[model samples]
Target: MRMHKVNTAVTLGAVALLTAAMGTASAAPPAGRTPHPQPAHPVIVDCVWHPQVRPADFMIACGDGNSSLSSLRWSHWDQGSATASGVNVVNDCKPYCAAGRFHSYPVTVRLDHPQPWKKNPRVQHYTQMSLVYTDGRPDGFDRVVTYSLWN
Candidate 1:
């Protein structure tokens, strides 16, 4: 009876350990990295109409730090055309600002392709943009920002 009780206790302990390990794994960050903070102050910085260009030009100002422009996607709301590209924030310019200081990151997107914006008679032009970022922490506060015009 003593041996059986000891074995039972050991089995229970093993099961608990396994459960905890699985929980931690499930709680892991998405894409194997922590997600940046969602944009708190989202605003359209510039919208330029260029007839010389087929589609148009769009520029957006997003958060300074503790954020990132993970994805830059656009669509022609009036014409139903869309295109996406992976922008190199670091290559373009320093995307982040001084820590704890409010900064604005400007992103300019020029549409070169002749898509719905050029084809649709009703739609003279259309433009849209999006930006995403990962939140920052006290320990990991020194973040390198990326921008287009800066670089």
Candidate 2:
């Protein structure tokens, strides 16, 4: 009876050892495939000093509220840059400030040149924005216009 008990104990110990060994072997990553570290995503600093990611609407004229972007459809948003297609809304101000006609134009937007935010040191924000007019642009504007965003 004692011999039988000793054999049973040995068998259980060997089984447990093999089970642990197998588990450890399978836990390692596959050969020739190293995990890649993901890049940090940058944000857009708004006029009100708010950090936003892929915002649908953004204001361009923070001082007088004369220009802005709307209905933005972002195609790419990554660590280095972002791209979108939207409409540029501007006040013509044909005669005066209060009696100005608003105009809308199709535009493609690009955001890049990431830098550390002034308000938040740890977070990065896109500092430059480029707008390419596809259909039409506002007066005194070129085919492509670049603006420095507020940080």
Best by TM-score: 2
- Badly placed stretches (over 4 Å) of model 1 are 28-151
Q: Please give the RMSD of candidate 2 to the true structure.
A: 11.2
Each prediction's number of clashing residue pairs: 12, 0
**lDDT of each candidate versus the true structure:** 0.37, 0.91
Q: Per-residue lDDT for 24 in model 1?
A: 91
What are the per-residue Cα lDDT tens digits for candidate 1 across 1-151? 9999999999999999999999998785877565533222222222233232222333333333233333455442223323433332332233434324433343323322222343323223333333222333223223433233200
lDDT tens per residue, model 2, 1-151:
9999999999999999999999988786788765542226888988888788899999999988889999999999987899999999999988985799899999999999998888876778999999999998899999999999987
Instruction: Give the clashing residue pairs of candidate 2, or none.
Output: none
Best by lDDT: 2
| C-alpha lDDT (0 to 100) for residue 50 of candidate 1 | 26
Question: Each candidate's TM vs. the true structure?
Answer: 0.22, 0.73
